[model samples]
Target: MQNEKDIVIKELNAFLQGQYMGIRAYEHLIAKLEDPEIKKEFQSMQQDHRLHAAMVSERIQTLGGMPVNNEGLTGKIQGFISQMMMPESTENIIKMAIKGEDLYGIQLSEEIVKGDLDPESKNMVESIIDTDRRHLDYLKNLVH
Candidate 1:
């Protein structure tokens, strides 16, 4: 039987892994993109994911939990797919980015609504969720 703190740690670690996955996805996109402006925007978003990963790692450590160092199997599979089948058009790239961000935003929102995290962790997640919304909005704008 897992206690609340342990469950929270597990959830946080999962979120951290998701951040790493986002970073990798952005990297794959940036490498494949031909446009300098879009690549720059993706790089910025990737940096934001890095910052989010750092914050989540710090909170996990503060809770006496070990942070995951890698993105795990799902990330690898997603990376593989991105490398093999990513679209060539700028609009398609932006749409893909928006989809990823939207999914992440939904995941983060679900975590908040779950009420499983401690106050500090919840606050950090809320901050990340706000940034995710901005990312989604930016990508959506690029598609319009």
Candidate 2:
């Protein structure tokens, strides 16, 4: 039977994978953006994603679980294409992605914190959620 630690690790691993997907998507979106400022915001968000992944990795290790190494084929291919394409319009792309990410961040945070999860897992999720809030705020400012 899996222990509580093991169960938490599984959930953390899944969450990490989602963040990995977000990072790649943002990177792709960034590549298509033309505005230097908006590009910078995307880059900042990408850094946050990396930090979130690192936090999850730490928790996984703490729980004696091996995290997944790859972002999977679809994420890699899509990220590659997004990076390769020159964005036709910076405003639209940034706005769309920012809204999506903001919504995702809020939803994920709520789920992680309010759901029936272990204490350790909940704490980590909350921490990541805090970071996401900051990212959302930054992106919101860009819209104005």
Candidate 3:
């Protein structure tokens, strides 16, 4: 098994890569959304992702790893799906975005429960998870 530092660095890098991917995917989704309110919420989500991405990247560097700036494999697949699928309707767009958010939250929750992070790192992940929960709630309420 990898050591604590290695595991944390890998997790943080994965988180950063995921956030960047979400940012790009959301931007693509935002353009197709016709509702001003929905578009505005997505823009807010994009901003939050950007903030998280920066935080994770900084943490990765602090852990003696080079921060990843390019899109990772998952990001590439997501980008491809978003572009190729071409969500034609607002409902489709919401479904796609919500699905991505749900998966991200689930993955983060698992990492948090694994109990490998140092105190500061754990705190950061928890805070981000809280923000993610809020975002998911808002999206669910909006869709209903």
TM-score of each: 0.92, 0.79, 0.88
lDDT of each structure? 0.84, 0.73, 0.80
Ranking by TM-score: 1, 3, 2
Q: Tens digits of per-residue lDDT for model 1 on 1-144?
A: 989888889988888888888998898788778999889989999999999999999989989899998788987887787678788888888887887888855565556437689888888888888898889888888888
Ranking by lDDT: 1, 3, 2
Which candidate model has the greater TM-score, 1 or 2?
Answer: 1
Model 2 Cα lDDT, one tens digit per residue, 1-144: 977677777777767776887787776787677778778878988898888888888878877899865566765775576556534676667566766577656675476566555787788788788877787777777667
Q: Worst ten-residue run, lDDT, model 1? A: 104-113
The reply for model 2, stretches above 4 Å from the true place, is 71-87
> Which of 1 and 3 is ahead in TM-score?
1
Tell how far residue 66 is off in model 3, in angstroms: 1.4
lDDT of 3: 0.80
* Per-residue error (Å), model 2, residue 20: 0.1
Task: Indicate the residue-level lDDT of 130 in model 2.
Answer: 80
In model 3, the runs with Cα more than 4 Å from the true position are 112-115
